[model samples]
Target: MKVLVVEDERDISDSICQYLANEEFLCEAAYDYHSAMEKIHLYEYVCIILDITLPNGSGLDILKQLKDMQKAEGVIIISARNSLDDKIAGLKSGADDYLVKPFHLPELSARVAAIIRRRLFEGKNYITLDKLVLDIFKKTLKLDDIDIPLTRKEYELLLYFISNKNKVVTKESIVEHLWGSEMDLADSYNFIYSHIKNLRKKLIQAGSPDYIKVVYGMGYKFSIH
Candidate 1:
């Protein structure tokens, strides 16, 4: 999965990114409100960790913008402002969960996972589509009871495709979702093609029917038919 960590504290932001990366998630950081705003608009993250106190603006503004944009990304409010009003306001503004500062990173990760499960997998830990089964926590993909080993990008790409299965996803959207706001350095779509090819190879080797369909001159789609 991919996540954006919008925090002003350099240490906290880096720590969160490191931890999530260790957990096999691609994480991007946004130090200030403006950067976070641009990121939130450009990328489609599975989740976002927003700190209420930013160098340039309140995280509340970020939350409001998220709601206004009708973004489907799960949000977790991580703030030193632990007042009841702040929590209330965050929930009212559409945050999925709230974590006070000084909390454990593992707990935060769990909460994010829970939100993803509820939102995307119908609250199931294992996601099954036809003969393909994926255990989100175990980080395992199986086809007809056979295991499939996937690289980090390949795993994330499979998840992205499954999440938007049957929908025509544009290359731009794929790039943004996979790389976040820092994709300016990615001048070519070669890396994306490579990842998709690898992911398809793994699935087919595992005895699963290929479902990732390339839409010529457009993008790709995941479908059983």
Candidate 2:
């Protein structure tokens, strides 16, 4: 999953990114309000770690923009102000969860995971489609009783495809979701084709139907029907 950390404190932001990265999440950091806005506008994240207090503007404003834009990315407010009012305001502004500054990294990670699970998997730990079963927490895919081994990138791609099943997903969006904002440095999207090819081969070999469909000049779609 991709996460954007909107924090002014360098130490806290770096710590969160490091911990989450170790847990296999792609993370990006924005120290101030303007940078945060730029990222939210440019990329899509599974979860956003937002601080209420920013250098030039309030994080609440960012939350408002997200709501106005109807972005589905989950938001978690991590603020030093632990007042009931702040928590209520954050929730009312569309934050899925709130965490105080002096919080443990593991708990924060768990909250982020839970939010992603609820948002993407409908609060379920596993997703079942046809004979295929995917364990979100375990990051494993199986065809009935047979296990299907996949690389990290393949697994992320599969999850993205499943989440948007039957919908056309552009290659640019796929790059942004998998690599975060760093995809700007990528030379080409040929790597996306490579990953898709491998994923298709594995699923086909595992006795699963070919659900991934190419959209010619546009992109790809995952359709079960």
Candidate 3:
């Protein structure tokens, strides 16, 4: 999943980013309201960890904007303010959950996962697409009831394809989703080719259908055709 962390605290933002990355999530950080606004306008995230207090603007305003615009992404409010009024206001402003500051990283991670499940997967812990199944909580993939071993990248690729099943996903989108901004410095898209090849081979070997398609110059697509 893709996440946006909007926090002014550099240490807190970096720590959250690192932990989210380790969980196989694409994370982007914004230190202030302007940066967060810019990012929200440019890309779509699965979730946003918003700080109610910001240097120039109130996090409540962001939440209100999201609510007014009816964005599909989930929002989790993290603030030092611990009051029923604050929590109620956040929820009233479309925040999915409220997390107080100085909390454990594990709890935050768990809340993020819960919100993602509710928003994207209909609150299901496992997702099944055709013959392939993904056990989200366990981080396991199964084909026809048999476990399929996959590298972290391979698993991420599979999940990405499944999430956008039957759609033509561009190679650039795939690259950006996987490597984020680093794709700009890469010399070639050969790495994408390698990962796709390995993932296809493994899925086929596991008795799963070949759903990924190449679109030549434009990009790749994740479709059953």
Q: Which candidate is the best by lDDT?
A: 2
- TM-score of every prediction relative to native: 0.93, 0.96, 0.90
Q: Which stretches of candidate 1 lie over 4 Å from their true place?
A: 184-186
* lDDT at 140, model 3: 91
Among these predictions, the greatest TM-score belongs to 2
**Pairs of residues at least 3 apart in sequence or in different chains that clash in candidate 3:** none
Q: Whole-model Cα lDDT per candidate?
A: 0.87, 0.94, 0.85
lDDT tens digits, residue span 1-225, model 1: 888999888999999999988988889999999999988876788899998888889888898888889999999999888899999999898899999999999999899889988898888999888888989898888888888888777787888888888999987878876776667635749988898988888788777888999899999999865
Give the range where candidate 1 is weakest over 10 consecutive residues by summed lDDT. 179-188
Model 3 off-target regions past 4 Å?
68-70, 185-188, 216-218
Candidate 1 residue-wise lDDT at 100: 95
Q: With candidate 2 superimposed using the best TM-score fit, by how many Å does residue 196's alpha carbon deviate from the native?
A: 0.4
Residue lDDT tens for model 2, 65-158: 9999999999999999989999999999999999998999999999999999999888999899999999989889999879999999999999
